[model samples]
Target: MVASSTTDAELSPTVRVLDPEGRDIRFVSALDPAGVVAHGWLRASHRAPDAERTLPYRPWHPHGRLDPLTPGAAVPLDIEIWSTSVVVDPAGHRLAVTVQGRDFEFPGEDPWPRSYGVDTKGHAIFLHDDPDDRPTSVFGGVTT
Candidate 1:
C-alpha cells in the first residue's frame, strides 16, 4: 500500500470566495473594481485587531497610473496575490464584496480605520486621530 499527502502549496492560486463549508474570511475596502484590481493589498497583523493578515495593495483613481504595493518583509501563512483585472458589474461600478470568505468589501459611511501609511520615499508612517500627532509628512516621502 502507498500513502500520499497534499500540501498547501499543491492547491490552486484561485481562492473560492464562497465555499460549501462554513469557513470564510472578510475584508473591508472602498476600492472600486479597477482600483481593487490595480492596487489590492491584504495583510494580517496584531496591529489590526479586527482584520486578519492578508496581502496589501494600493488604490488608484480612474485614468491614473497604477502604483505597485510596498512589499512587507515578513512571511505570511498564505501566499500573497495581486489581481490582474478589477471585476465590475453591468452598471460599471466596482463590485462590492462582503462575504464571509476570502473576499473584500467597501464599508461606506463607517468610521476610518487605523492603518499604516507609506510615502513615495518608502518611509513608515502611522495615522493619528488627534491633531497633535499631525506632522509635516505622513511618512518621510508623503507630506500632508
Candidate 2:
C-alpha cells in the first residue's frame, strides 16, 4: 500500500473498510462523522476480493448497482451508534480512509489539516466492485 501522509484533522468524517477476515480493505478518513457526505455529490470506493466498487454520488445510482435509498440496497447493520441509523449511498464512490490517532480533531481548526476515522461499525457500508475493473486487494493490519 502507498504510504499516505494525509492526516485526520483535515477530514470531517473518517473511517476504515475492513474485510470479513478483519483486514482493512481501505481507509476513508473524511467520512467518519455523521455529516461528512450526508448530502450532496460525493464518491465512495472499495474492493472485495476481486471486485473494486466506485460510486459517483449519494442517493443511489440510477443505472442500478448500489442504491442505499433503494429498498434492497440497504446493507444490514450488525453495529449501531448514538441511537441513529445511517446508510451507504449508491452515489458516493469511496476512495481512501483516514487512520485514527495523530494530533487532529474534528469540527476544530488545526495547525496541520487532516482527516479523522469515521465510525466503522454500522455505518461501514460499501459497494463490492464487479469484475472488468482492476482487482488487486489492499490490506491493513488490525489496530485498537
Candidate 3:
C-alpha cells in the first residue's frame, strides 16, 4: 500500500500471476486476461501483524480493531503471494514478482478503472485500478 487515501479505508487488491507471453496465468475463472493468483484485503489502519499468529512465511493480522492512518502517511504492508510451484520453460519463461497499480491494462481489455474498495463505482471487474486506493502523489515516488 502506498499512502492512506483517507483516514480509514479498505484496501482490496489482487496480485496478478504473469506469464512470459503477455497473458495472466489463470487456472480458473472465465474472465478474459484473468490471472489473479492471489488476493488480500486489509484496512489501512489495521495493518499491525499478530505476533502470536504470524509465521515466517505467512503474516496474520489481528484485525481486532481499527487504527486509522494519517493522511499521506507512508505505510509498509506485508502482502503474501501464496506459495506456488511452477515449471518454467528454458526457452524464455521466467518467474518474477512485480508490484502493480491500477493503471495497467492489457490490449483490448476494459479501459475503465474497476475496483470495489471503499469508494468506487466498479470499473474493470478484476483490474485493480481504484483511484481511491492509489493516489499518484504516493505511488509516484521511489520506495526503498
Question: Where does model 1 exceed 4 Å of error?
Answer: 1-8, 15-76, 91-144
lDDT per residue (tens digit) for residues 36-74 in model 1: 222222212111221333334422223223222232223
Order of candidates by lDDT, top first? Answer: 3, 2, 1
All candidates: TM-score: 0.17, 0.17, 0.54
lDDT of each: 0.25, 0.26, 0.51
The number of the candidate with the highest lDDT is: 3
Tens digit of lDDT per residue, candidate 3, span 94-131? Answer: 44444443323334534433344421112134434356
Better of 1 and 2 by lDDT: 2
Inter-residue clash pairs, candidate 3: 102-129, 114-123, 114-124
lDDT for position 52 in model 2: 32
Query: Residue by residue across 61-122, what tens digits does model 2's lDDT show?
Result: 23333212221232221111112233443454343344332212233332322234332332
Q: Please estimate how well model 1 matches the true structure, expressed as its whole-model Cα lDDT.
A: 0.25
Query: What stretches of model 3 exceed 4 Å from their correct place?
Result: 9-17, 29-34, 96-144
Off by over 4 Å in 2: 1-13, 16-85, 103-144
Better of 1 and 3 by TM-score: 3
